[model samples]
Target: MLISVIIPCYNSEKTIAEVVSLVIEEIGKMKGYESEIILVNDFSSDNTFDVIRDLCDKYSSVKGIDLTRNFGQHNVLMTALHYTKGDIIVGMDDDLQTHPSQIPILVRKLNEGYDLVYGKYPKKKQSFFRNLGSKFNDFTVRKLLKKPKGLVASSFWAARKLVRDEVIKCKNYNVHLQGLFLRTTKRICNVDIEHRERKVGKSGYTLRKLLRLWASCINFSIVPLRLSMLVGFIFASLGIISSLIIVIRKLVFNNIYLGWSSIMAALFLFFGVVLMVLGLIGEYIGRIFLCINNQPQFVIREMINVEEE
Candidate 1:
């Protein structure tokens, strides 16, 4: 069986070569299993692609792709999936955090009749803010994507080629791999693994980028839009109830006065809710517009040791 390992490289020129070597070494230890490495450089501002090219030259089974721009990690993964030719596909990070040593655990779990296997960290080795962001993302996926309970999803995961084929069918501008995975199959399991500390630069994800990635979940679910409607209904009911109370008080006590501050506060609260709901609706429409315009998920700049089909 051939196992293809897909990695999305950012500015990881320092760590990628070692990562590839370790991946090769680990797969070499697996009996009856061959290995292929697919590295997609997500338009890193460093010499990341050059390192990937060198690895491709050194290893016959290694493939490299260069993106025209930084198309986010998930998009880059989708691009790599198009060129994968392995029976099983494994995805890991460019940074050593997802560690190559844990690949066998996911692959072994996958052989247990599961379509997908995620390498869940027993204890993540990320900063406080990154952990917080991950928690929020996990919650979002569980609720919005209908992810199976207790099935943890992470960067380090293995899936069958059928799952990969289904995932790559998603041509939307926004790519959320977990959502796509859940949509593809429910035969998913998680294996506990160690998340190593980063020995190179910090994470490429910023606060803004994290939020944008979270927003991509909208492509797979309408829960956010439904929540917006629910919130609007609740606020509208509150407005009606408050107005009734004010009218009753005015009728019962003629000397009672409605303060300008209270009226302004009510107006501000209702208007804020109204604008928020509008903005959420606008976001949905904007994404639809982009999809309808045929937005490209990713544009490949170059490829090494990969053939276009």
Candidate 2:
């Protein structure tokens, strides 16, 4: 069986070569399994692609892709999935955090009749902020994307070819791999693994990028829109009830004072809720417009050791 390992490279010129070497070494020990490495340079502002090209030249099974722009990691992964020819697909980070040594554990777990296997870290080796962002992301995935409770999701994961085929069918510009995987199959499992410290630069995800990724959850579910509707209904019900109470107070106690200040406050509160609901609706519409316009999920700048399809 052929196992394809996909890594989305950012500013990782210092560590990608060693990552490829270790992956090759690990797969070399699996007697019946061969390996193919797919390195995607996500428009890194460094010599990351150069290193990828060199790795492609050195290994016959290695392929490199250069994106026209820094499509997010999930988009780059989607692009790489299009070119994989392996029976099993594995995704890991360009940084050594998702270490190559743990690849076998994910692959072995994948072989246990599971469509997808995620390498969940027993203890993540990320900064406090990054870990916090990860927790937020995990919570959102479980609630919005309907991921199975207690099933951890991470960058290091392995999946069958069928899962890859199903996932690549998603042409939405907002590519959330966890959401996509949840939509594809429920046969997902997690294997505990060690998360190594970064050997190069820090993570590419900033606060803004993390929030943008969280917003991408809208692509897979309408829970947000539903929540907006629910909120509107609750507020409307409160408004009606409050109106009735005011009427009763005014009729029974003619001296009851409904202050202008309270009226202004209620107006401000309701208007704020209305504007927020409108903004959420606009977001949904904007994404639909982009998709209807056939926006490209990713544009490939170049390829090395990759066959023309």
Tens digits of per-residue lDDT for model 1, 145-194: 89877777888999999999899988898998888998889999989999
Clashes of each: 0, 0
Model 2 C-alpha lDDT per residue in residues 185-236, reported as the tens digit of each score: 9999999999998887787888898889788888989999999999999999
Task: Tell me the spans in candidate 2 whose CA falls farther than 4 Å from its real position.
Answer: none
**Leading candidate by TM-score:** 1
Off by over 4 Å in 1: none
Report the poorest 10 consecutive residues by lDDT, candidate 1. Answer: 146-155
Error of 2 at 54 (Å): 1.3
